[model samples]
Target: MLSQPLSKVLGKKTADELIRQGLLTVGDLLHLLPRRYDTWGELTELAQLVEGEHATVQAQVLRSTSRRTRGGRPAALMEATVTDGASTMDIVLFGGAGLMSHYAKQLAPGTTVLLSGKVGLRRGRRQLASPRFQVLDDLSEDEREALLARPLPIYPGTDALPSWKLAIAMRTVVDQLGDEDVPEPLPAEVRAAHRLVDALTAWRWIHCPQDEEQWRAARRRLRYEEAFVLQAALARRRVEHESTHAAVAWSLPGPQSLRADLDAALPFRLTAGQVRVGEEIATALDSTVPMQRLLQGDVGSGKTLVALRAMLQVVGAGGQAALLAPTEVLAAQHRASLEHLLGPLARGGMLDGAVRATRVHLLTGSTPAPRRREVLAALAGGEPSILVGTHALLNESVQLPFLGLVVVDEQHRFGVAQRDALRERGGVTDPQALPGSQERRTPHLLVMTATPIPRTIAMTVFGDLDTAVLDETPGGRSPVATHLVPWEREPWVEGIWRRAAREVATGGRVYVVCPRIDVTDEELTDLAHGSLGVGADEPDTAGLEDLVSALGEDPSPARPLAAVTEWAERLAAEPALEGVGVGTLTGRMSPAEKTAAMEDFASGRTPVLVATTVVEVGVDVPGATMMVILDADRFGLSQLHQLRGRVGRGDRPSLCVAVAGCEVGSPAYHRLKAFAETLDGFALAEADLELRSEGNVLGAAQSGRRSDLDLLRVTRDARVIEQARGEVQAVIARDPGLEHHPDLAAAITERLDEESQAYLERA
Candidate 1:
């Protein structure tokens, strides 16, 4: 019955309405938990009602009047004065004559009613305009008392179906529900251990609770159930992946290998965190079970170096490794960084190359045809080499027959399918293999993210992968000081340009970050007419939308925001920055343009580079000492931290000035203030989680399809998630296939959709 379509139970019209809200099955409707509970035991005081505020009041109607308007179209107006024992207010309703007649008969004098509407002041008297009211006189004495005693569940509802209507529909369905409808997903022993209620009882109490305690208990049970099913699915994925997948076991490099030679030729010693994480990756690479590891580190923490070393391990063992970046800029940057770091080792076929070296090649969407063919041919040759590229690497034509390791940089930018596609492209089938011999192999995966993930998120989202953290920076890396500047303050705004000029004068580079590439004509018109601020248009990207909404800002009629094009042009002509070369970089720019701009900035020819978040991740300029983020509030805390990380890479002390356009004390402003106060990526990650929703735990941040997580909050449910993880691990340990827990298995299947299941499998 629970699995049956909602239309089978409720009438078709009502069922369709609920289905439109993503509640398809009876079980889905049962899980549509109430947003909150409203109590009728204490009615809102009429005298305390504030104008323009929504209020729900219980009172007795003392007098009533009905009249027809003489104006344009005939309309009926009904007015009634109501009063609690202490004070009185007016309720006004406007509608057709038939509706007014009905309201007049229903709201007769001496009738008790419960009314809800926005309070307004008319002729210096408080009144409710077109209030929704329920006549209490119709209910029996006992029912009236029951209503006053028990709290009413208020669900998240649409305009056509209010909370009260949803409650009625839920009650109708729940009344006919039986034990078989909501089977016990949790085992008896597990329920006893956790002090949780049965599934049926939880569902009943969650929707129609007798008291606050009952509902709280119900919520707790359901929250745990959500976490348990999620964790169980993840555990099962891990079990299946380990058992089914086979990978090349690349051993630790010998003294003369490329990995060892790179380490020996390094200009600086490895940090303790890097050394520890490197060992973790090395161990995973040496396992035939296939490596599934996530390497997360703070900005400037040498994550790239660690990943490079792991890739070299595969190359040294006579297998190819691919580094997948999310953008062409990052891919090209990675290629250049690898070449610079490896020096002669990256030029294996050249005369000046190291004897035991291998080649490093780049393949991007913009790669020239001849060069692209050359890279593809080299990969198909099965010779040990390192290949770096963007999403183009996932193309069908790009194959690595002897691939042993895959390193994905800025892992979150790519979807699960993209990552899996690259992994699936590794190793060819062996037709002559014996029955027990490994028929095919997948490459080991090492995904790196510079954005530190909070503990709960790491467990919930990346639970299938082993995690390694590089928390320390290399020696000689400069410490960055962050400051928040209000955009409304003119002196502070002028100081930004002056500071950039000063940094340029000292031969240090500066990065000026903007939220958008350029302003649109509509925005320019709005600015010229002073009707709306610049960037009044909605954010071009969903990320900015989510950030703005999470910061509690209305994206419509957006505040004035900075743009790379406008800022670059303005700064180039600024008196303070006169003759100080300013360059522009945005994602819309061609690869050559971006590279040239970055090159000029790196060489100090263009001391100031104005760009968008395109340089958020892997752009390294050691000489850059200052970063100015215009409209910093438009960016997420993690993203702002990443942008700030572009500087302070060298021995010079760095500073990051975040210019906030949000009002002082707003959520976005506080977020920027927090970013300015701390350089700790982990702490900022937690702050980021608090300020924003955790999004879809199963997939990409904003993928709404798999975001069925209504009860389990990754931010505030740390203990619950941890407990669920432990319980799941123990259960999976006892029953590898969950064969003994059919109900739990069913629950897992019900909770995870096809996309979510696929995500977990690929994750």
Candidate 2:
């Protein structure tokens, strides 16, 4: 019973209170895994140490000096000298004596201390500052040497608390748990079949592993747990709610309804792709099993028309439909386009009179209560026929009278829960429920996105779903002629702007884009909120303070990048492009404001729109054929591709200029270059994933898109993810109840941690 709380680790009792939330248990502690492991073991003589070598040296502190800032503790500056058998080396410790009070107070001026760090030559002087130090106690030389060997785990930590300290603290607690957390839920026979370890052993080995041998044991256990719960939960709920759910195979008003709608809506001819996809959708909507289809296309590839046509079938069958988009802008775009494309269908009564009107109701967060209530009523009464909205449609208050189909736009942005929310609107309780009005009816789904999926990935990722790719763009829209300019040759922007200004003067618009609105580490209190989403990331104010304090006596370095308004100001003030009214738009801007800014650019009111990626998704300005991307290398290929799509909308020939600054090179350069060379978005998406760094893939989990993982370079393990998913599905199909397969259930239970579930197939 030597169990002390995490208070010892965090230096505060408050964090220990987190144990009450189940985060302090040894099983949970083990799951707070290390991001990396760094070893500073190669003990070498200072004279023998080469530049860039991470060398460890035993040195004696020769002298110490101290200084105080305005009100903070005075940092002690230490200068130490170390020697081997033949030569001596000078080691400078910038602020160790005073800053690290605990360490300094423990070691005397002339004491023998061991330093571990990389050797660097600064201005011809060998330096070893801010090196981690260990005081030699009564421990034997071999014991200390063993502790310094190989790599030590680096836990995820905050600035107030370092990872090394966290690991040490965790190790102490884990020692008490001995071999496991809860007992293994799987049968012994199943463990042997899958060649897996019991749950307790897996977690125990994961956190306090003696070697890499335990990595798979821990990982598989966690992965299984995550997948199993998600699947089982979905299944359990689906079956429970099946009674009220109506699984309607066909909602069409027979051949007469389609013929009448098509006959009345024949203003524009459907492209072959659109026609084919429409038929496929109709067939899916009329099917027995719940339909899950993805309609993929490049920008302006005529996707909205296909979606609208599918929704029309629900209308034809006496049922209502809803279209959900990720953002207000996108939702609005879809609403506008949906109205125009299905105009003939919505007017309902007349076939040959005035302009055809589609009774497509719009629902978003900003919608007035009166209007939303009206829209909701209309939807229940099947008056609007179809509804278009953002996540507001998923609200519990939004009732569906007879919802037959639900279309999710930018489908990848949503997760299983969000999609399931809309699917459950018609009343299918969960996945196990058969089609029809039982517990809850289920609606057919048509997921659409502007990004085309690679055929192979699409097949595996959406194995159970049908798919259609809109590969061609409409005829009149010209392909943008793209050019790539290296960082040093960024002056190409001048040439592009001069030419762009000339074009705008003759009635065109220009879009100037940067990778980020502001890189300044400080967030403006006014502009820190996310426009469309409910929440945002909090600033690490404490961490920032600690970093500044760690700097000893220098002013805090500014974070790079300018915010939207600031960027707009700088672009407008450019002496070379004076008087070019520059408007700004970003996630920081209000939806109404962003819409207004975009409208200005579209109407040629603002000739130059200096923006971030906000304009990359929606906001079509056909007049904006001239796009100048500053610091293109900083953007991912998929993003660049999306930006490139902003133009080339009109009949006019469009131009895109991607400019890179000299300082940034390497992989980024190649990525931008690849995007500039091809207009193919799918190719760019793959390249973007491949070239992306660690932060891009794993950081957005808080946004509810945790399932979006990248195994680009880890293509070797892709088969494993697919195998797991398929195996899970097959297991469920064979044994809908876990009563028959204890081993599979056990494996899944072990792997279902928050992080594992988030990454899942994508990781």
Candidate 3:
């Protein structure tokens, strides 16, 4: 019954509306818990009501009047004075003559009613204009008393079906539900330990609570169930991985190995944090059990260097290593950085170098056919080398022989399927097997993200992976000074360019980041013609109604978002940068074009580069000392921090000016302010989670699907999550197959859909 389609229970029309909101099955409707509850006896205080705020008040009508409008086309209007026990307010109703007469009859003097609307001030009196009203005088004394005693549920509803209508639909389905319909998923022992109610009782109380305590208890049970099922799934995945998977044990390099050679050739000393994390990774790689690890570090913290050392160890152990980046630009940058670090050693067999040297190859979508063939030949020959590329490396044509280590940079940018596809290619010969016997070995996986993930988030999203953090930066890298500039203030905006000029004058470079590539001509034409129509020809407005309902209509005219193309032109013409060369870079540019632009900026031929967030990660230019972010309010705190990291890489002092286009005191402005005040990526990550809510932490944020999490908030319910994880680990340890706890096993299957299971499996 719980698995039955909503249409089978409710009518087709109502089911379609519910489906539009992503609720499909009977169980889905049962879980659409009320966001809040309203009590008839606890009326809103009219005297405390603020103008321009929505309110719901229960009051008695003192008097009522209906009159015709004075306009040539006559309309009817009804006016009444109503009073809660302590305060009086006026209510206005406007409609056709017939509707006004109907309203007047329903709102007669001495009538008690419930009204909800936005409060407005009319002629020194508080009034509810065009309010929705429910007459209570028609109800019997017992019915009125019952309403006053019970809490009314208010669901997350739509304009077409408000809270009351949804309540009726829920009542219809829940009335037919029984113990068999909602089976208990938690083990009896666990339930008794946690003092949680049975699943059926909890479901009923959650949707139709008689009082506050019943609802609270029901919510607790459901929240725990959500966490338990998810954690159980993760624990099961861990068990499967440990039992079934094996990886090539790439032991520590010898004193004369490439890893040691590179360490001796390094220009700077590694931070203590880096050394610690490197040792942790080295230990994992030396194990035969497949390594699943997450490396999280702040920007410019030398994550790439640590990853390269691990890669070198694998290569020195007679196994090839692969580094997967999210973009071609970053992939190219990695190859270049590796070559520069390796010097003549990168040439390997092609040039005179150390005996332990190995070649570094680049494979992206745009790689020339001949060069691609050469790279493939080297990999097919089973040579110990490093391969760095984007998603192109995931193609079936590309093979990694004796692949040992897989390093994913900016792991959040790629989906689990992409990462797993490359890891599955690691096939090596088993030493203990007979000669020529090959076995499929899972490569040691290390995923690195510069965007620091909050603690709870890391535990929930990456629970299957062991984590290491590089919290310190190498010495001599100056900390970036951040400032927020109001976009509306002309002088403050001018000061940004002047500051950029000053940096350039000192032989430093500047990066101007914008929110968009460019405003197209078609967009301008649409704006000019006000062509935001809802016809089939205007498909862009398909969801306009839903958006308007969610956000409401803003009275202020919309402003154009800053664009790199336009800003680049405007900045070049600015007097402060009149003589400084300016170049533009965007994702739309060809590979050659992007390389040329970056080369120009790096060489000081173009000391200033205007770009989008394409340079947000792993694009290093040490000479760039200033970053100016236009419409910075459009970016999240983590992204703003990443953009700021592009500068301050050199020894010179650096500055980042965020030109906020949002009004002061708004949520966006507050986010910008929080970002400007801290250089700690972890702190900003927590703030970002709080401000934005943990957005689809279970793969949806990357896959563009709805999150599996419904009731569990990673941040607020950290303790509950921790408890669930501990209990789940113990349960799985005793019963790896969960045969003794069939209900709980079923719950795991139900909670993790195909995609989510794939995500957790890859982890």
Which candidate do you rate higher for lDDT, 1 or 3?
A: 1
lDDT-better candidate, 1 vs 2:
1
Top of the candidates by lDDT: 1
Residues 1-763, candidate 1: write the lDDT tens digits.
8888989989888899988888899888988889999775445799889999888898999998888888755488899999998898989988677768888889999999988888999999999998868899889888876777676899888756778779989998888888877777777877899999998888889898887888999999999888888888898888888888778788887787888899999988888998898988898888788888888888888888999899899888788889988777778889999999999899888899999888999988778899989889877767689999877887888867787888988765555676678898656433123323435688888888776443334453536667898878888888999988877788989988988888999989999887666676343222221110112121233233224353346354356567777888999899999999989877656678878889999998999998877788788899999999887776667678888999999999999998877777788877887898899887887776666656577754542223457787776787888888888899999998989999889988888778777777776
RMSD of each: 5.4, 8.9, 6.8
Q: Which ten residues in a row have the lowest lDDT in candidate 1?
A: 529-538
Q: What ranking emerges by lDDT with the best candidate at the front? A: 1, 3, 2
Q: What is the TM-score of each candidate against the true structure?
A: 0.86, 0.64, 0.81
Worst 10 residues of 2 by lDDT: 540-549
State the displacement of the C-alpha of residue 746, model 3, in Å, after optimal TM-score superposition: 1.7
Q: Per-residue lDDT for 539 in model 1?
A: 20
CA displacement after TM-score superposition, residue 705 of candidate 3 (Å): 9.5
Name model 3 segments beyond 4 Å from true.
4-25, 43-149, 158-160, 254-256, 343-347, 431-438, 452-462, 516-565, 588-593, 665-667, 697-700, 703-705
